[model samples]
Structures are given as structure tokens and as C-alpha cells.
Target: MLHVLFFCLCLRQVNGEFVDDEVKSVMEGDSVTLNSGLTEVIDEDLALWRFGAENTLIAVINVIVGSVTVYDDVLDERFRDRLKLDHQTGSLTITNISTLHTGEYQLQTNSVRKSFSVSVYASLSTPKISRDCSSTSSSSSSCSLLCSAVNVGHVTLSWYKGNSLLSSISVSDLSISLSLPLEVEYQDKNTYSCVINNPIRNRTTHLNNTQLCPPCPECGHCCDVTEAVIRLVISALVGVATVVVLAYDIRPRKDE
Candidate 1:
């Protein structure tokens, strides 16, 4: 548990030789520059950036002589011709963000002698679902939910139903088309969400929800669980805020 907590902290880091995932509202086909603070790398120093979902580094962007060189680790053969890097500017660019491109990216760099690490997040293309989807007869068997991430030379996929983790598969990116069987009842009106997460970036998509209808007989119990989950989430947020506030309040002023 302590190790897991430490890993989570490492993933959520913001500054001081660290990169935080900023909640940016970006549209498609926009180029955004991710700066690694000029302070971290002085002028004339070499810097590099590598991106991946887990232990392996999928793509690399090398910087030298005020230029960048990109090397892509071809996990899927399809990405061989698709991925490109700007050697002149040290910018990593993907031609078109597809549903498969959403994953965590690891940025590793060096400043003269010392090495530093950072993370970048990419989001999945969220195709909106019609709000007027009024079909309770639709069962889970009609659709599928899948979340995927690259982990240590393999991609891990997990399927879920509401809060229950149903099935998972670990395979090479070339074999990532596996599917899981599901059966959603008409009463299961909950929106099924696929939260694909890695150390760098995380993407979430709502697969589907049986159309809203009259309350189920177990509506009261479901409501109780929903309320409980909400309270737990809120309490966790409040606790984190309290810790931050208290830590800042007690820190000595640098001017002193």
C-alpha cells in the first residue's frame, strides 16, 4: 500500500523537476508547446523526451545543437510510418489523434550531467453520444467496453460494468483486439465508463447507459451506494485540500 501511494504521488506531481497533468481544454489539431522550465535545462545543454504508458519507452525525442530527433519504438507496426518528430524544434507530433493514441507519456531528459524525468498526458477522442438514446431494451450484450494501456512491452486491457471489474487481458499491441462478453439488463441504467489510465496520461469514455426509465426496485440501494461513493470522493478531495493548506501555512517564508 505504501509503495502504491508513493507511485500515485509520483504520478500526480506538478513541479520541481516534475511535470503535472494540466487540465487543458484543447480542440483537435492544435499544437501546444510543453515547456520543461528553462531553469531545468540551461542553454547549450542536451535534452531528451520519451513517451510510453508503462515501463517501456515507446517514442523518444532527442535534442542537441538546438534541434530534436524522434525515435519511435514500434509497438504496433501500424505506427511505424504514422509517428513523426520535429528534429528542428524538439516537438512530438501525431498526425491525427485516434482512439488508440490515448496513453501516458514519459519524458526523460538530461541537463549536462544530471538526468530528470517528466510526464505528458494525452486524451482519447471523445465522440459524444446522443442524449436522446431512449432504449431500455438494449442490453450490455449489445455493446462492449474496453480500456487499454501499454505496460512493459505489452498492452493491458480491462473491461468493467458499473463499479465491477469484469475481465482483463494482457497482450502485445498487435493482438489488442480481444473482446469481453457482457450482459446488461434493462434495469441497469448506469452509464458504463471505460477509464484507460497510465502513469502519464489518462482517458475516460462513457461507453453507454441503458436509457433512463422508471426507478428499478433496487433503486434505493443503488442510490445509497451512489451517495456513498460521492461522499467518499468528496471527503478524499477535502482531505487532500486540508493537507495542502496546512503544509503551506506552516512552511517558513523564504524571505526570512
Candidate 2:
């Protein structure tokens, strides 16, 4: 057993031109196809499809003898009932993809050789954002938001203040719902967004801090005192300046 393990490790060390690297991205529970680009097969031709860096034999198609074999005994459980071959093109289809299926796939024939790198991503559900009122404080009524999703894998959950990302978390193959929290003070006037994503797709929700967590106090809501005070002072100064300008113009009425 140790010798076989050592040989497999050693195999990972070799790289060669016979490897025709292709990239394929498929969502978890989905299907993907690897094509051989062969339009015809002859009696003397030999075609083989394999998986992994070790090139474990997967399927064989001998059109000359009119036979097809899916070497199930050599395949892992994930590929059982999931692999199909096209006799004409020699393309392979993998159904119900999962993280376990992510890896290298190889196709070999008498005349040509090729390879593929397949990546399986979990589908991320649309994120739901809800207000968390218990996070309120006396000095400032903060708007805390919770973003959540379910059944995600190999993906990231993140919070963004406009285009600038704030906080992010990642996991692989989580079949349950998870959430991330974001807090913004009432006076915060910037835009915030929450996102759940993988390399294939992203779902995002946007929030305007001023509208969602307005600065003014209402219904026993916490408000930022310093920010409200600053607003009041600015309003007062603008009023006083307007009165002074009117008085100056009115006092010159004698010249008119």
C-alpha cells in the first residue's frame, strides 16, 4: 500500500505536453461535457477516457467492435451512474457534479491526447438581509444587518461598503444556511451591500445607510447625538447668514 501511495505521489511530479489542459466550470448537482473533437471512429482506432492526475481509466469505446464499457469497478462512487460516453465524438458527460468531482480528466486515442481541469461550484442562493434591532446603543442607533444563505459550497459570503469590500468569509461544501453580520451607525451615509458568490455567479443586495438607518430618532429608536447636533448647528448658521444678507439689502433702501 505504501509503495502504491509513493508511486501516485511521484506521478504528480511529472508534467508533459501530452496534457492538453482545458478548464470547465459546473455548478454542484449539474452536468458537464468533455469533448474529444473526433467525428469518426474506425475499427483500428483505440480511444480511452480517464480521470485524475493518475489517469484512472474511466470509459472505453471501440466502434470497430461496436462496444462501449464504463469501467465502473475502477471508478469512485461519485462517478457511478454519472458518466456517459459519445461513441461518435468520444465526449464524456459527468452528471450531478459535486466538489468531489473537481479535478483533472484525460482523453487518449491512438492519434491524439487531451486533458481537462474541471471545477465544480456550489450554487449560492439569493441572500436575505434582515434588520437586527437589539444592537441599538444610546450614543447611536446602529443598524445591524444580517445576511444569510443556504446549501452553499466552495463559495464566499461578504459585506461591501459600496465597491469596497468590508468583511468576507468562505467555506467548502456547507449544506446548511450561514450568515454574516454588518453594523453601521445611524449617521453613516454610505451605501452598503451584501453578497454571496462563487467563481461562476454572485447574488448581491444593496442598502442605503441613511434611508435604512436614518439619523433622526423615532419610536424610541437610538440616534447619534453628535451627528444630530452638528446638523442643527449647520442649519442655524445658514439661517443667520440669510437674515444678515436681507438686513444689509433692506438697510440700503434709502439709496433706492
Candidate 3:
């Protein structure tokens, strides 16, 4: 049995380093377990878990003693009440993890040190489509579009036309909103969409020029604009005709 377990652990390593799963994604406010899988832990055998590049200490466990100690100096309120250490398996569990918790983690024992990556993403927020006309007060034929996702974390925002990717932005932050603009032409009929996604799930909003942005009218007024334009044109024509008639009738007795 010991030989079998040893072989399995050896297979999990390359050269001399223990290679972790490429990346594990967990939704925010959820839980995950990082298994150590080390057996026959003895006294004086210490297991350590650390996070980030500098390897800020998180927790330490004594196998034979079956005791867990967290490094409060390094892991303040952020990890309190949410971190768990299992003495039997040397596994670490995190509950209610936020986007701030996304990073690479390291586990070290006397025998081997292993590394794994974790990415925590928030619940997907719906992308919002809003008009970005040249004139905000009135409609304009030249209107772009803005798609936004509010206060999302560790995700990507992208604009697509059919299957072709137009543009995309990635956010590593856990608490900020982001927007992407599409320079759409007037009466654009192509199927365009704004999608916000994490590795696990995504949200999308379809573009509609008619719904969010309508064509600008000749007049700025929303109500009776067409009628007002017609009346103004007629008045200008009538005034021009009167001037022309006067000029013709006066010719020198005329036109002064």
C-alpha cells in the first residue's frame, strides 16, 4: 500500500517538482478543497500552506499531533472563520471565497512542496446596453453603443459580431465595473452581442439599434417635429417668392 501511494505521488511530479492541476475555477461565495494526499504523517512532520508570490503564510498543521495553527500576523481578518485544515489528509478548505482570494497557492511538507492555482469569480452580472449618441439631449444618426457590467470580478468583457470577435477587455479586480463601446453604424442589422464571462459561466446582451438608439430627426423636438419642419419650409418658400415678385415688379421703379 505504501509503495502504491508512493508511486502515485511520484507520477504526479515532473523532474523533482510536484505539478498541480493547471487551474481550478470556483464561483465567489463558494467553497473548494485543495487536497494534500500525503499519508503516514508523523510527529515532527510539518505541513505549511501559503498564498501569493511572496508566500504569505496562511496555515500550518502538525500531523501526528493533529493540531492546526493559522498565522494571524500574515492572514488577518480576510481568512478568518473561512479557512480549514484537515490533519488526517493535510487538505485545506476555503469557504465563501471572494475574488480577492484568487491566486496561486503553495503547500509544503518535509518531503515535497506542491503548487496549485485558484481563480474565484463573482456571480455573473447582466450586461447593460445603452445609447451613446453624439448628442445626449437629442437623437443623432451617428450613435455608438456602450455595454457595461457593474462591480464584477475576475472576468472578461467582450464584443462580438456573429462569430467574429471584435474587441474584449479583461478585469482582474474584484470590485469594479467596466464598459466596452461598439462603433455601430446607423440602422446596423448585423447580430452583435456584448458578453461578460468568467471561465465557468457568462452573461450576454444583444445589440439593438432601434430599441436603444433611434435615428435623429431633422428637428430636435420629439413631438410634432415632422410637421414643424414642413411648416418652416413652407414659410421660407413663401417669403422668398414674395421678395422675388417685388424685385420683378419694381425694376428701377423697382428694387431698391
Clashes of each: 3, 0, 2
Per-residue lDDT of 213 in model 1: 32
Ranking of predictions according to TM-score? 2, 3, 1
Candidate No. with top TM-score: 2
Candidate 3 lDDT score relative to the true structure: 0.75
Q: Write model 2 residue lDDT over 131-165, tens digit each, in one string.
A: 65555554556666777888877778999988998
lDDT of 3 by residue, 1-256 (tens): 0000111122266787656543567777888777776764463378999998889989998765778897645655678777888767678888888767889788888875677687776788899877654435433454667788898877899999997999999987765789887776666678889999876788888887466464444335655777788999999999999999988888978445
Report the C-alpha lDDT of model 1 over 1-256, residue by residue, as the tens digit: 0011112222343455544443222222333333333443334345555444443444444334444444543556424444555444434445433334444444445532221232223333332222222233355434322233332222344555677876655444444243333334445666665444333333455654544232444657888999999999999999999999988877766435
Give candidate 2's whole-model lDDT. 0.74
Off by over 4 Å in 1: 1-17, 23-46, 58-68, 111-256
Which of 1 and 3 is the better model by lDDT? Answer: 3
- Candidate 2: residue 233 lDDT (0-100): 100
At residue 148, candidate 2 shows an lDDT of: 80
Error of 1 at 130 (Å): 13
Candidate 1 global TM-score: 0.31
**Least accurate stretch of 10 residues (summed lDDT) in model 3?**
1-10
